[model samples]
Target: MVTKESWSMSIWPMAPWKITFLIYQREKLLWIGIQMKVAAGAAKGLEYLHETADPPVIYRDFKASNILLDAEFNPKLSDFGLAKLVQLGIKTHVSTRVMGTYGYCAPEYALTGQLTSKSDVYSFGVVFLEIITGRRVIDNSRPTEEQNLVTWASPLLKDRKKFDLLADPLLEGNYPQKGLHQALAVAAMCLQEEAATRPLMSDVVTALEYLATNKDAGQGGILEEPEEGEEDHIEADS
Candidate 1:
């Protein structure tokens, strides 16, 4: 599935899943053009899964690891073991067992075995949170209860003053403050505890595209102090 760009991508070292991450070190290209292109590509991949996949594949187990990357760092979503298909008239898909990475599971589906399109929405929200924060979905270093990524991050998303605290320390504060705020709102919508409130994947993709396009005409920054050695959160689309 190469788009003919120097051609250097392969799914080597397969594990429990069929995905692999592109081994990018610190920063690759700081150009606004490349970054926005990668972001849109990621959004489009998710859009295909939600709107184009037959029966609309619900990547029930979406996580950072499940997102593979290409030479250009474009995201390619992987792993279909837990993928679900919603029938034409069926409200939801039920499975005998709930299966998903602990930190990536949608709350409602985690409690009840019923899976829906919104379940994947919640996972995307988690991925969005990681993209914004540059943090792992589940880090054990945090205090009990706080160790849960979504629960800990959800509150900060609602408050601007507090939201900055969640940004990756490496970024230091080198991005568009207002744009970051807008992205936070989008993340809040996707991470809604109630599935009914989350935006459709198509809507999420649209919002991201608009943000990138609007910001492209001006400056390109994600925080106040961008660290040259900051880790890239390109896995957000996984």
Candidate 2:
């Protein structure tokens, strides 16, 4: 859990992630550059929690809804209710009851009740994929094959020719194709089912920082409305 001191600090300067969704709803656009910025900033935040913190931390809840942005759109991670401290050199994971938002949870953690920094990495990958695709982590309204964003995107992630298909259709070809490939590559690394295979958050931060600096990463994406179908998939903590 987040310490009392950490809890006492203010987090009021920025817009919440949900507000970002509202903005997209009104303007029909969320820039690819902006997405990269958010991803990089959030990655740095997680890097600190995982590598630079005194004891290291597992940001057990690292989903889009938990991120906030300042007026300049710099991202801040919030809600540490699910955060866990790690004793580096002592153990590899924190054994505990499984918890976290379903669609964003790492498969290993969700199945084994073992939490690690890499679990946060997986969650970050899901959010990154959401940024690139403009799709929710899970949306039941989509066709069955497409409901789980990760599973649906897995095959396309491997084929260079189908990379474009993984991009948000709402981007409408505005983003730099090369940058999209790099961003997706980072996401693919983090989404590796084997926790040990995921890159450390510091490495993820480095890659994302470089991606964010590319001037041609391009402009905007519209948030498409989900088509009519069964109830939307839940993202409730479990």
Best by lDDT: 2
- lDDT against the true structure, each candidate: 0.65, 0.75
Q: In candidate 1, residue 80 scores what lDDT?
A: 75
Q: Give the top-scoring candidate (TM-score).
A: 2
lDDT of 1 at 191: 87
lDDT for model 1, on a 0 to 1 scale? 0.65
Per-residue C-alpha lDDT of model 1 across residues 1-238, encoded as one tens digit per residue: 3346654344444332212221122132332233334445566776787788666777789876777655555666766777777777786887889999998888888898778888888887787676666667887877877777788887787777776677655555555555566677778898888899999888988877776665422133243333354324222211
Error of 1 at 30 (Å): 7.4
Badly placed stretches (over 4 Å) of model 1 are 1-39, 216-238
Clashes of each: 11, 0
lDDT of 2: 0.75
**In model 2, what is the error at residue 213, expressed in angstroms?**
1.3
Off by over 4 Å in 2: 1-32, 216-238
